[model samples]
Target: MKKWFSSAIVFTVLAVLVAGCAGGNTKSGTSESVDANKGEKKPVIKILQNKIEITDKVKAMVADYNAYNPDVVVEVQVVKDYLTMLKTRFASGDAPDIFTTAGYNPMASWSDKLVDLSNEPWMGSVSPLTIEGMTMNGQKMGFPLAFEGFGVVYNKDLFAQAGIDTPPTTFSELKAAAEKLKAAGIKPYKEAYQEGFPLYHILNLGFAYEQDPLATLAKLEKQEMKLADLPFLNNVFDVLDLGMKYGEGQESLGVSYDSQVSDFATGKIAMINNGVWTIDPITKVNADINIGMFALPLTDNAEETKMPISVPGYYVINKDSKHVEESKKFLSWLHENGEKYLVDSFKFFPAFTDIKATDDLGPLAKDMAAYVESGKGITWTQSAWPVGYREDTVKRIQAYIGGQGDREQTIAELQKDWDNRVNK
Candidate 1:
């Protein structure tokens, strides 16, 4: 553990204290079951999540669970500004009964708040890959949802039409692909830069494509290397420029993420950036679209490209919640009955070992699956970023891409803000 991060964790304790202390442990399931059996009111289990893609599927799951069980009520709430809201709720000591948790260092920061689910009944039925992805220091903090990957999603048919036979592996090749697509009178890509999160996701992959991103971040934490001195940040700047220069005009600044997905699904653009969560919505628009994904190569060799793949998020129970036991039972139910929902409904690759993929997870996800199976897939490391890093960095990126600033200014802002957050 880095010294600065220890101080950061200590801040969270005072945060929740200044906010308020939580009430007692939640009503246990046995009592709730007894009340329901007596035709009395059932206890409610509240779940908060950030997965905007599967809102409908989760709602349906809640409905189905309520109908069959009839002993406890489950309420699902989608937080649009989930990550930001997650920290606020936690600091306020108002953490939800069960909230979605990310993997890696970010999840570890919440180790004190989360009830370890490693010894839960569902652990035996989950895939070892998932268990590994969600575990930290031998303690599993939450329920792993699925195998996930993200990169640049492209139209294979468009590539062929543009006389490009292969996805770009290096930065130069990506530039060439864009030029060919532009020459073919088709836009090379579409972006929603106005949104911080989509931009944040790009930076995550861009930074990770470096020779050793984790090591680089560790050095940054230790004040050993400057962000600009590294070769990758420069490449990231050029890649940011790549998206902006070839993007779909000024209208793209305001293009919502859904619009980006719809446009890419309809083949209006040759490429887009996103993950497998876009699969269901894209397929719903054009199930037959020859969608493909490749790791965004910011280097000279395409063969070296490795897509980041891992458990993106998990379901965590609040240890201090008034509904801990109820939350546990609710999660156990999902573990048992959610196999089909995980597949047909959510369309995510199931985290459970008992469930098998009847068909491919999706077009892009197929490549992601292969990468993970080969042990070449990278883990999404942005989950380790400090809370305000995304908001701060994205603003600088938006300014740079929008032609309002230069690389020096952007990098300066990044280093300054990072230092402020850590040193505070």
Candidate 2:
């Protein structure tokens, strides 16, 4: 895993040639339409992204971009099961000019299809750690959307009400803290099992706890490791067990992300195993909710605790799109003027060093940044896992947590899935 502490990737550009790259098939008329009144063609740059939570905000941002650049029309499309749908769009020859993909393996899968962005003006200002996930064979093929970290976020006032002095950093302490919160009549956790992604973060802890998490993941990719053979996994399952035992009960399977954030924001729940991304929705629900974040300790070894922090996703241009240059220009404009939206509208920790994260980015971001600064942040190992792995893995986990299978059975199923995914 790359440590993102204070390192920078400084490439002094003699001058930013705001000109377009020289190659690629430009299907001119296909991406632009003649305005009926003016008889003028206005190019359209379509963007397809996966983050449903920020669909509106992204659309709003695009509106602002369109207003600023009236010559081009930038359209945003947010989809569920983004990768699968994106593949479908590509197969149908309806691919967007710009799209989003998670870093590492997912980015690698689409590297050939992406525009090489190594020389993009924004490249100089981005953190090397942010760039690392998007680079393949020396070509930077993707632009990082933001830096993100996840673990456990807790309500500070609720903790105080429960007489808990400090955030727990170990499984035993976590269990004790949960008990205290429960005793005080606060819901210990609002586990959002309805969405497979949150449980993915939980299951990912199994890999993140390994001595060499990325190496261990690579072993699995090469069929040299099995989920059951990995140590500290029982602790990962224990954390899940603890969440279900002390959380909002089996009904948690129906708890949507919105409700989970709202519950925590309103003091209905004291803690939740989520990420800094929740800060935006949380502030909208209740701006004054005092909260803090800490690594979800996977075992009794407090020393092993670290927040999983990495570039959650990236924006890449389709190399073959007719609007490749337009897409690049749009991305450039967004990043150059996006600091305000990134901080205020998106509640993001800017991946680019030029955009500073302000003090008001919420306690979760601040605490996660501290972890990154202290070199205690770990990789989001799932980013390197097989594309579409989480949807299946989280389902099996939900089954086990729902009492549909034994732990061994679930692990076996997980291993079988990995083998089939790798081989097929």
- Models, CA RMSD each: 7.5, 5.7
Q: What TM-score does structure 2 among the candidates reach?
A: 0.87
| lDDT (C-alpha, whole model) for all candidates | 0.69, 0.77
Candidate that would win on lDDT: 2
User: What does the lDDT come to for candidate 2?
Assistant: 0.77
Write model 2 residue lDDT over 1-424, tens digit each, in one string: 4444436321110101111111122233257755666768788777777656655666677667767876777766666677787899899888888888777888898889999999999988887777668988899988776777778889999999999999888889999999998898888988998888888888888888787887898888887878888897777778888888998667778888888888888889888898877777787889888888889988777777877777777788999999888899987887887567775676667778888777766677777777677677677778877876877798898888788888888889888888877777
Each prediction's TM-score against the native? 0.81, 0.87
Candidate 1 lDDT for residue 193: 70
RMSD of 1: 7.5
**Residue 55 miss distance in model 2 (angstroms):** 4.7
